[model samples]
Target: MAKAKPNNKVDPNKYLKNKDIEPEGKLGVAAAVGRMGLMLVGIVGIATEFFRDDGWLKAALGKLFESTSSMMLIPVIIFVLWLLNRWMSSESKSETKKSGDIPMYAMMAVGAYYLFKLITTGSL
Candidate 1:
């Protein structure tokens, strides 16, 4: 007839002292979602403009912008997700690994492309 006693000496704060398990960096989801929402708003604006207009060419071009704007957001969204993944991963190799910074540049490139198109087309 032997009785076993439970160990009550485990300290929860001991885990907190370990830096390797701690989380770091920002999650890019909120930013990505916000950007997508802005792009959607831009698309809706373009669509409304098209429906309100009488010229076929102008309407078609407006719709192109509507669709393209959303398409352009796709890469940006992927980039954001990649960043969040890089931030949240705990593996040491993952910590040292870097995500492509090209998405930021891609956003700039898209902005420039749209600006150039708008200027050359004189559609604004």
Candidate 2:
């Protein structure tokens, strides 16, 4: 019987000590950019659809919410309250607030306004 030959291939992982570092090669950069482009396109498309007055998404949401009777606002209120709690309770004690929190603050204000209006007028 013939003896088996030894495998000579080197394991690349043995040389790569820091796996957390991103590859600096052209292929890696291209792949990263391609992924970012796809994500940006998808986000833009969704935003456009949401902004359009006659979009199917808006129409569908309107139809669905019409029968819910203030139930839809419950989730929005809960989410805004959660965001406020998270922002206030963050470990980092930074004097300046993040720009991302602007949208959350706006949502909280709007939700509070609607809640106040609902209580006062007894209508949506």
Q: What are the runs in model 1 whose C-alpha is more than 4 Å off?
A: 1-27, 53-124
Residue-level lDDT of model 2, residues 49-91, one tens digit each, is 5678788688867776777665588688789998877775656
Work out candidate 2's RMSD over C-alphas.
Answer: 20.0
Error of 2 at 112 (Å): 38
What is candidate 2's local distance difference test score?
Answer: 0.65
Which candidate should be chosen as best, given TM-score against the real structure?
2
Find the candidate with the highest lDDT and give its number: 2
For each of the candidates, the C-alpha root-mean-square deviation to the true structure, in angstroms, is: 12.2, 20.0
lDDT of each: 0.59, 0.65
